[model samples]
Target: MPYTTAPVLPPGTLSRSPQPVLPTGDGLVLRPWRGRDVAAVHEAFQDPLMHQWHIRRSDSEAEVAGWIEGWEKEWEGERDAQWAVVDADSDRLLGRVALRSIHLVDGLAKVAYWTTAAARGQGVATRATATLTRWAFEEIGFHRLELLHAVANEPSCRVAEKAGFALEGVKRSAALHQDGWHDMHLHGRVRGD
Candidate 1:
């Protein structure tokens, strides 16, 4: 069942040849992940919000480091693009944003993001999402980008709206979290929208 033909597009069509750095124009920088970011990444995931929303959890530094390494592999395969959201002034970790499940044939992708507790309420997620959306649409030539979050996560919904993603609809009981199945709201933005 594993055997199949090649993908619709050759490698490097979805992801940038060299991952680009995106600046939010508000002192927030989105850049490639580094090995040295393990500590900060580990700490950020320790936040209760991350645990509540994100299914993947990293309990140890080694696990966090592996996660960072996977980002590079994702880029190499043109499967997805991830960036560490950092503060330009101090190079501190603010959060992370990524384009996941990128399908070149459909010209569609999903956006996922998280913000450290300290960085929340400062528009970090909104800014990062907006910057990434623009980059994906204009630079990478993606036709559409989508974002989904548990219906209970109001802040994330707000971020999606502020980033210009329109609410499409809700997928009832579509996501499983620690609290069990939760309804998810899907928001999307198409090129030129």
Candidate 2:
């Protein structure tokens, strides 16, 4: 029974266009993941800090390759979009940013990101998030984007705030890490905000 308004965004909204490379205007670029980025991705997941929040690490290049493939498939499926944050001039991988858990019918998605140790303190995550958010709103026509992080993940909380996502509330025991469950902070940003 289809008793509802029209979908906020139609099918093939994102899949129609090729994934785009975005500029952060802060000396960083958000580009689609490439086969050559396996090393950087592998190294990033190996960081103890990365494992703390993401709860997974790449043990081999092969696994990272599969992960890249999955990102590509997700883009083609229009279910998610992932980008490798890199130095604009050097093109060296600095981190990653993504719009995950996309709901095209609702024009919504959950944004996520992480920065390499070397990229830390450089505002890579925040700048990349902002750039992606603007694109999702203005270019792709998403209505709302969410940012979620474990309460204990203070750095991510900061990034979300800096990227202009307003803290709406906390979800109890929302995420499960290797250590255990953690309460999660939920931040949200609509197209105008």
lDDT of 2 by residue, 32-131 (tens): 9999999899988888998899877788999999999999778888888999999999999999999999999899999999999889988999999999
lDDT of 1 by residue, 30-83 (tens): 999999999999998888888899998779999998999999678877668899
Cα lDDT computed for each candidate against the true fold: 0.89, 0.92
lDDT of 2: 0.92
Residue 20 of model 1 has an lDDT of 82
RMSD for all candidates, in order, please: 3.1, 0.9
**What is the C-alpha local distance difference test score of candidate 1?**
0.89
C-alpha lDDT (0 to 100) for residue 63 of candidate 1 = 94
Question: Candidate 1: lDDT of 35?
Answer: 97
